[model samples]
Target: MSAPAAALDWAQGVWDWAAANWYYPDEPGRGIRPRLIEHIRLSYASIAIGLLLAVPLGLACVRWKPLYPPLLTGVNVLYAVPSIALFFLLLPYTGFSDWTAIVPLAVYTLVILLPNVVDGLHQVPDHVRQAAVAMGFGPLRRLVRVETPVALPVIIAGLRVASVATISMVSVASLVGLGGLGRLILSDGFRRQFDAPIVVGVVLVVLLAFATDALLVLAQRLLTPWARRDRPRTGSVRRRRAAATAAADAPALASTAVAPPGKG
Candidate 1:
C-alpha cells in the first residue's frame, strides 16, 4: 500500500479501537483530551514555579556579578543533561511522581530563563536608571517602578520562550507513565497506528505554542507601548513644540531690535 493508504488504514484501526476502548472513567487514561490537559497543566505549572524561582535569582545574580558565570554554568550543565538520564536520576527519589516531572522541567527553565531575564534587566538604558536614582528613588523603588516596567517586554519574551520549551519537554514526562499526549503517541505508534498519534501530537503542540506566543505578543503591546510609541514620531512632536516656542519669542525679538538700542 502507498504511505497515505497505509496511514489511513492505521488511523481507521486506531479509531475503531478508540471508539470501543476509549472511555475509561475510573482510570481517565483513554481519552486524548484529559491526557493533553495533564500535559498542559504540567508544563504551565513547571514554567510558573520556575519563573518564581528564576526572576528573583536573576535579580540577585545581577547584584553579584562575580557569581553569575558559575551559577549560569551550573544551570546550563543541568539543562544539558539528557531528559532520559535526568528522569532516571530522579526516579530513585521521586519515583515517577508528579514531582519528578515538575522538578526536571523547572530546572530546565532556569537555563533558558535566567540569562534572558538578566540580559533584559541590563538592557534598560543606564541614563533611565540614573535619572530614577537622581530623582531620589531608592533601589527597590527604581527596580519596581522604572527598571522592571521598562524591562517587562524582554522579560516576558524570555518567559514565552521558556514556556514553549517547557511544553515540549513535558512530553518526556510520559516516559515515566505520567499521563500526557506523549502517552498517546507512544502507545499508538507502537501499535502501528501512526497517523492518529502524529496528528494529535502535532496539532496540540502547534496550538499550544501559537496560543502562548500570541498572549505574549498581546502582553508586550500592553506593557511596552513606549517601546512601540517612543520613535521618530515623537521627534515630530518635539520639533512642533520647539517651533511654537520660537514663534512666541519672535515678536519680542523683532520689537526689541526695532525699539532703538538701550534708551528705554
Candidate 2:
C-alpha cells in the first residue's frame, strides 16, 4: 500500500483503541486531550513569562555593555545544564509541581532568545539612530519607533526559536507527571505498546512545530510586508538607474574641467 494508506491504517487502529479505552472508568486515565491541553498551557505560560523577562533584559544588556558578559554567561550555563538534571535538581525543592517544569523551561528560553535580541538591536544602523536623534526623538522614543520596528523581524525570529525550544522541553516535563504527550510515551512505552505512543508524540510535535512556523510566517508578512515582498526587483531597478545616471555624469564633468589639455 501507499504511505497515506499505511498512515490511515495505523491511525484507524489508534483511533479504535482510543475510542474503546478513553475515559472508560476502568481505564480512568486514558483521555489524552486534557493532558495535551495542560502541557500546551504550561508551555505557553512559560514562554510568555520568559519573553516578558528576556526582551527587556536583552534590551538592557545591549544598552549596558557591562551586564552582557555575566548575564549571558549565567543563561548559557543554565542552558548547558542537562534538562533531566535540572528537572531532578528542582524536584527536591519544588517537588515536581508545575513550577518545577515552568521555571527551568522559562530559563531555557533566555539562552535561546537573548543573544538574538541583542544582535537585532545592534543591527540597527548608526545613520538611523542619528536621523532619529536629529528629528528630536529621545532615547525611549527612538527605541520604540525606530529601533524596535527595525529589529522586530530578528526579535520575532528569536521568539520563534524560543517557542520551539519551550515545546520540546515541556515534553521532557511530562516525565515529572505534568501530563503531556511525553506522558503518553512514557506510559505506553512501559507497557510495551511501542507504536501508539511514539506515533502520537511524533505527530503532536510535528504538527505543533508546523503550526508555530506558519503563524510566524503570517506574522512576518503582516508586520514587515517589506521584508517578504520582492523589493529589489522593483525598487532596485529605479535605484540602479539613478546610480547609472550619476556614474555617467561623473566622466563628463571631469573631462570638461581638463582645460582642453593646452589652455593652461
Candidate 3:
C-alpha cells in the first residue's frame, strides 16, 4: 500500500478503537472516563503537594540570594534525570505504589515551580519592598501582603508549566502498572499493536495539557485583577469609538450648517 493509504488506514483503525472504548454502558473499567479521572487525580495531587513544598523554600531563596545558585543547580540536575529511571529508583523505597510515581512527579514540579517563584519574588520592585518596610510591615507580613500578590502572575505561569508537565508524566507512570489513560495506550495500542488506543491516548494527553494550562490562565486572571486593568474594557472601547464617530461627523455638520439667506 502507498504510505498515505497506510497512514489513513492506521488513523481509521485508531478512530474505531476510540469509538469502542471511549464510552461505557456497563463496563466502567474499559471506559475513557475512569482513565481520565485517574489521570487528573494523580497529576493534580502531585502538583498540589509540590506547590506546598516549594513555595516557602522559594520565598526563602529570594531572601537568601547565596543559596540560589546551589539550590538551582540541584533541582536542575533532578529535572534532567529521566522519568522512568526515577520511577524505578524510587520503586524499591516506595514499593510499587502510587508514591513512586507521585514523588518523582512532585519533585519535577518543584524544579519548575521553585525557580519561577523565587524569580517572581525577586522581580518585585525594590521601591515596593522599601515602601512596605517604611510602612512598618514586618518581613513575613510584607512577603504575604505586598510581595506574594505582586508575584502571583509569575508564580501562576510556573504553575501552568508544572501542571502540564505533571499531566504528561502521570500518563507515562502507567508503564509501571499504575492506572491512567497511559495504561490504555501502552497496553492496548503499543503492547498489542492496536492503533486506536494509541492515537486516543496521545490526543487526550495534548488536550489535557492545553485544558489544564487554560484553567491556570483563567485562575491567574481572576486572582490578579490588577493585571487585567491594563486591558481595554468593552465600555471604554465603545466610548472611544463613539467619540471618534462624533468627531468625524462634526466637520460634515459644520459644512452643512444653514444661515439666514442674505442676512450678511
Candidates' C-alpha lDDT: 0.72, 0.71, 0.78
User: Considering only N, C-alpha and C atoms within 3 Å, which residue pairs clash in candidate 1?
Assistant: none
Instruction: Report lDDT (Cα) of residue 168, candidate 3.
Output: 79
Candidate 2 residue runs with Cα over 4 Å from true position: 1-11, 18-30, 232-264
Candidate 2 lDDT over 1-264, as tens digits, reads 999999999899877765554454655456666556667787788888888888888778877889999999998888878777788889999996888888888888777678877888899999988999999998888877888788877777777767766776677776777737677667665458667766666577657756765576567658875544344556677675565445433433343353122110
Among all windows of ten consecutive residues in candidate 1, which has the lowest summed lDDT? 255-264
Which lDDT tens digits does candidate 3 get at residues 39-98?
888888899999997888898888777988898899878877888888788878988677
Cα lDDT, model 2, residue 123? 91
What is the model-wide C-alpha lDDT for candidate 1? 0.72
lDDT of 1 by residue, 1-264 (tens): 899998889778756755654457877756777777888888888888898888888888877888789999998888767876777788899897887888888887777788877887899999998999999999888877888788776677677767767777777677788736667766665457565665666567668867875676666666776655333545688785565445433433443344222110
Candidate ordering by TM-score (highest first): 3, 2, 1
Question: RMSD, model 2, all Cα superposed?
Answer: 15.2
**TM-scores of all candidate predictions against the true structure:** 0.77, 0.78, 0.81
Better of 2 and 3 by lDDT: 3
